[model samples]
Target: MDFKLEFGITDEGKLILADEISPDTCRFWDTKTGKKLDKDRFRRDLGSVEEAYQEVLFRLLGIN
Candidate 1:
């Protein structure tokens, strides 16, 4: 699991996280099958984009 972050500078010279984290911003793969479970499916025309996103959600929420 790898993710990206965006930062912004506030008027008071504070650096704050400026991006929403989601599957679109990260890469995930199945540990056993090495299948991609991120946005790559959409970009690469791999199909099952929705299912991949749902799988990620289920895994994150500890669902079966």
Candidate 2:
């Protein structure tokens, strides 16, 4: 559930939200198993990195 957000100031001094929110840029875990389903898999040298990302996509978009 942890994520990162970026902010930027415009020429008119207006604060704007920047940056993309995705599995590649944030941490996602399974509530039941506490399994990582983000980029951390690749960082930790865990196998099935592709499957992890696909799981996220399926959970979000209901796709297989």
**RMSD to true structure for each model, in Å:** 1.1, 1.4
Worst 10 residues of 2 by lDDT: 41-50
Root-mean-square deviation of Cα positions for candidate 2 versus the true structure, in angstroms? 1.4
The ten-residue window of minimal lDDT in model 1 covers 41-50
Estimated TM-score for each candidate: 0.87, 0.84
| lDDT (0 to 1) per candidate | 0.92, 0.90
lDDT of 1 by residue, 1-64 (tens): 8999999999999999999888899999998999999989888988798999999899989999
Show where candidate 1 strays beyond 4 Å.
none
Pairs in steric clash, model 1: none
Backbone clash count, each prediction separately? 0, 0
lDDT of 2: 0.90
Per-residue lDDT tens digits of candidate 2, residues 12-60?
Answer: 9999998888887789999999999998988898768889988998999
Best candidate per lDDT, number? 1
Error of 2 at 35 (Å): 1.2
Instruction: Judge candidate 1 at residue 29 and give its lDDT.
Output: 90
